[model samples]
Target chain A: MTAPVDVSLIVIVVVITALVFDFTNGFHDTANAMATSIATGALRPKVAVLIAGVLNVVGAFLSVEVARTISSGLVDEARISPVVIFAGLIGAIIWNLLTWLLGLPSSSSHALFGGLIGATVVAAGLGAVHFGAVLSKVILPAIVSPVLAGIIALTATYLAYRTTARADSGTVTKGFKAGQIGSASMVALAHGTSDAQKTMGIITLTLITAGVLSPDSGPPFWVILSAGLAIGLGTYLGGWRIIRTLGKRVSEIETPQGFAAEASTTAVILTSSHLGLALSTTQVATGAIFGAGSGRRLAAVRWSVARQMVVAWILTLPAAAAVGAVAAWVASAGTVGIVLVAVVAIALAAGIYAVSRRRPVTADNVNDVGDDAAVAHEPAVPAR
Target chain B: MTIDWASLGLVSVVSLAAGVAVVVLVSFALVGLSARVRPRPGGAEDGAPTLSAGAGTAIAAVCLAAVVAIVGFGLYVIVS
Candidate 1:
């Protein structure tokens, strides 16, 4: 038999590349957790992002059990190639940018999972997929986690207002804003623990497959540092498009609602992370926001906006997978194929950026979108 | 079926727990500090930073550093 591949170089490259994706994940999804607070004027924009960046780093250290899930549970690590992972990252990055440009709060978790699943299926056939892990660990959690968070937030919001019914509006707002600081931080910590590890796991899996590292090995120091730094920097840049959508469109978040929503989200996210569940923080946060709104009143939640976000959520996995599968198919043609995919992805990104310049959405213009604004400024119904 | 728990870095685990404790404690402290500093009608403190944004950022940073260090060490052990 041929000697094992000298995977050291590939490991180094894939680890760094994975970190690049982690960093993008951080910036891309920051809006999912903090947009509502920023939109409500609960936190200054810069201050909000800086805090998220730091917490994301801290959270990354909390657990690696989820990383294990990603490394071993998602696919048969024995059968894949580093090139497949690279192509999948490209697919994910492209989808993330496309959705981000339109200011949609799509699920980054789903995108990553989709990318892995797609690449594995294309590279090694469907037998490589761990359906049990996909279902019990990823898919089921994705569906149930958000709904559970929403229910908890709804109950908490209902109680929060009831207990303070005699208090004046000013008193309630002030109290909850004070409480919000603690709850929000918990969510951030939980987010880092849950999300950053995906990259770590992927990199580790790449190392194992390429024979650069043992099968039982965890992510290396460089992998962890690079992933954390990348995500931290991304978090600092902030994804303002999504921030407006989540912060303003879902609900008019008063202080009490914000407090309850944040508290419930923290509880749900932390519990999931500890259990090694790879649930989407975006879904949990959004569900909590919706529950908080409904707790106040039926009309408090903008159903139209919620519908649009749901549609994006439903499309995230399938769309990213389709892109990844196509990229994998093309890349299978070897070096020329890889070059073509890269070129097309780069061109698509540039084109999206050019179109976005027409109505630029920066931190400055993030909050400018009004309540009636449709998803991507076009009318769309909920996909699910 | 035995697990080598030592290789997992128990210190890192404790560090993570400590970080969470610190966030919770600091949040309570901040709220109290804001209460002492800001004088509003009905004693409501509006200036306190929302826990989700500020605390979230701090926690994320800490976790990132920890993960980097732990994974870095893991790499060293495996590579050597």
Candidate 2:
């Protein structure tokens, strides 16, 4: 990497690829923070995304601690080449687009980490993969974070309904709607502080592998700014399809339910990250909405849709890892391998985008009648 | 390495406590403020006892301020 100029080019491609993943991560997760707000009319579809976009950029600049861990603590960074990273990024980006096209809100963090681990195992040996750290940092948190979030949201939703039972219904709606704005914004801001850093971590690890930065160095200013801006722009675009799935398909959220879900999301995300555990914001938010929906009546919730999301969450890691393993095997051939992976990834992404347009779900149609929504419930599946 | 169940436990406990506190306080604030609004002719609240304006405002203010403080702490956790 020090002598070969091609390695630097690969590093640049890896950085760009990481930003693209960040972009998908942003739109893929817009549902997590803004879906409830949009669903309950607390904020207009456009305004909710606008505020989330701005808060995400502000939040990205707030911290770098998370970036450091993803760069060094997860794997033997010293053994990885920049091309390995590029392959991993491609795997992650492909999975993200595929899930988005289906309108399933999968865990982007799991995909990213899975891709990296897969590439590392293929490029380096099994010894280079730190199983202990993966177990503690990745596997355990995935199981624990969402369940904890769901429990908190369930309790919060019950308490809100019970306490406000005697109040005027209209008054309750108004108060909770006002409260929704704050809680949803907190989740958005917390999202920025958390998910944005994962990209920064990948880029920093790339720089270190390429010999552009010393070992253990944090992400440079340029890396942070680009990651933040890319995510912010994507957030503004809004993932209308997934938003519809979570907000409308999962349950018809009332203002009180929306506030409970968003507040629980904020609390769990902030507390977990503060304690040096960066759980998937997507899982936490999804579980909160599920819990909020269940708190009122089990009959109202569309359990089938919730079940679909759980299946997606379960498949995210292994699917991305499989793709990443194949890509890493190809990319080991040197510059030819990197370019090949990049071209194939771009083609697949473009294909997914094209297929999504067949039954477009923009902000306008995002909240149509729930009986036959177009999100993933469309009985026909075109080969994605 | 053994799983750090204790850290996970701490996150669950603190998040639940903080999340419930915020929701309850906001609900109370809503109840108190609604109690201050004079009952309209044929309104649903016509039969319920309305709190005095002073007591209603004080309760609403206190409850809302507590929510704000909790939110402020959340912000601190993110930034600091």
For residues A1-384, what per-residue lDDT tens digits would candidate 1 score against the true structure?
222466554455456657767877997878756776676667788888888889888777656767777788777777888878877787787778888887787778788878777877898899988887677666666777667767767766776666555333454466456556655666676777778888888887887888777888887776676677778788878988778777766766776677667766766666555545677888888888888778777666778887777888888887888888888888878878877887898798799879878877677777775544553454333311
Q: Each candidate: what lDDT?
A: 0.69, 0.87
| Number of backbone-clashing residue pairs for each candidate, in the order shown | 42, 0
TM-score of candidate 2 versus the correct structure, residues matched by position: 0.95
- Residue lDDT tens for model 2, A13-35: 88899999999999999999999
Docking class of 2: medium
Once model 1 is optimally superposed onto the true structure by TM-score, how far is the C-alpha of residue A300 displaced, in angstroms?
1.2
Best by TM-score: 2
What value does DockQ give for candidate 1?
0.04
